[model samples]
Target: MIARSQRERLLEAAVRVVAEKGYGAATVADLTREAGISRTTFYAMFDDKEACFLAAYDNVAEALMRRVAKAYEGEERWPDRARAGLAALLGALAEEPAIARLALVDVGAAGPAAQRRYRAALQRLTPLFEEGRDFAPGGRSLPANTSRMAIGAVAGLIADELAEGRAEYLPGLLSDLLFATLVPYIGPAAATREVGGNE
Candidate 1:
């Protein structure tokens, strides 16, 4: 059986190759050569280029989630945790530009498998915001409908910012946008204070 480490190496190589050459132009042969593995080993690990792309997408998602989790640690308030998590996510995008492109942009090009993976990632992440609903001040809560809208808004904003080459400024911009949106529930005075304190 192939080692997990070897699989990771191949996935990493695939990410780099795909980011450079794009999905249509990237080949399993290119990935295997980049990973310094035999074609047989590549096939043993992944069924095809599409399968490999899915694995690479999973890898990027896991890495981004871990960064977010780390950033959320030690924050007792929900708003603070949300801001920190979003900031960490944006930071990851800045640090790993390929992952931002893969997770947000190129994902659509990867077909159904990638779409499922993206949805799953968003589902897993939703709980973090849900957990912080009480932190909106005065025991205010986020309605389920609004929460979904907020999540979609934030994701779309980040994706657009990354595509526009403003990824580095996304954390602050996202935080302000979310804070403003939540101000009605949390109270504009309190929300402004929180944003000012955080900034």
Candidate 2:
């Protein structure tokens, strides 16, 4: 097999180090040790540990977002799109629990810049949720802020699940998240019906 690039090795090592030691306790030395690279190489590749971590966050978040987008594609109905997207995201999280914790949990604890990246990552999903407004039953549109909150709510729930080492169970949350996403626009009865079909 071809060897991974130095940058790729460093990012993967960063995720592992953060997952094992946590962002607050992890250091450049630890990351370099995990990557089997010298400190000099680490500096050559990244400005610092935080910089490397932020890059890792972007990498994981973008990859997961792409999966969700792909899963949602070709599904005209909103609920179908949502179920597909949610399942894609949860599957990714379950398959890469370390990366999931690094992106969803440790990134926020890395520092202010990481916090910003986490917010940006979460905001990236807002457009996906915002689209739900258009398909809301009766041509109803949810408040713009509510759509944003729904995105944040899903992130927060996922973060909590990851923090508790429940990443493998995220796929089970599809219906609950779908219900939450639909509730703001469609009333309870309709949202329940939407989530129940699971088509």
Candidate 3:
């Protein structure tokens, strides 16, 4: 196979370094050493570690988001769509624990700009959750921030697992996540029923 470019190597290293040592502790030297590139090359590719990390974070988040959107496609019901989308996310994260941590848990500790990116990444999922409002009978009665809150609930559940080094078990959370995603718009009885429905 052809060799990866320096920029790609640096971004990969950024994710690895952050996953291993976290953003505050990971240094430029650590990134260079991990990527097997010189400091000069690292600087040439990225202005700094944060820039490199943000790029990697965005890459991982976007890929995961795309997987979820694709999984949700072809499903007419909102709950099925949410389940498919969430299952896709959990499976992807389980396959790459480091990227999972980097995308959710580590990004929070990466400083203000990284935090902003994390928020933006989470916001991108709102449209997926917002569709529930139209499907639920009590959709009009739900609070205005229901979609944002539901997204937070799902993210919180996943992030909790990642922070505890239980990324591999994320797929098992499908029911709980589905409940959280649906509970805001639909009552518990219906959310639980939907979660327990046929795959």
Highest-scoring model, TM-score: 3
Task: Give per-candidate clash totals.
Answer: 0, 0, 0
Q: How does model 1 fare in lDDT?
A: 0.75
TM-score attained by model 3: 0.90
TM-score to native of every candidate shown: 0.86, 0.89, 0.90
What ranges in model 1 sit over 4 Å off? Answer: 137-142, 180-190
Residue pairs in clash, model 3: none
In order of TM-score, best first, we have 3, 2, 1
Clashes in model 2: which pairs? none
Q: What are the lDDT scores of the predictions, listed in order?
A: 0.75, 0.81, 0.87
Clashing pairs in 1: none
Write the residue-wise lDDT of candidate 3 on 166-193 in tens digits.
9878999999999999999997999989
* Model 2 TM-score, 2 decimals: 0.89
Give the range where candidate 1 is weakest over 10 consecutive residues by summed lDDT: 132-141
Candidate 2 stretches with Cα past 4 Å from truth are 1-4, 137-141
CA RMSD per model (angstroms) = 2.6, 2.5, 2.4
Q: Please list the residue runs of candidate 3 whose C-alpha ends up more than 4 Å from where it truly belongs after superposition.
A: 1-4
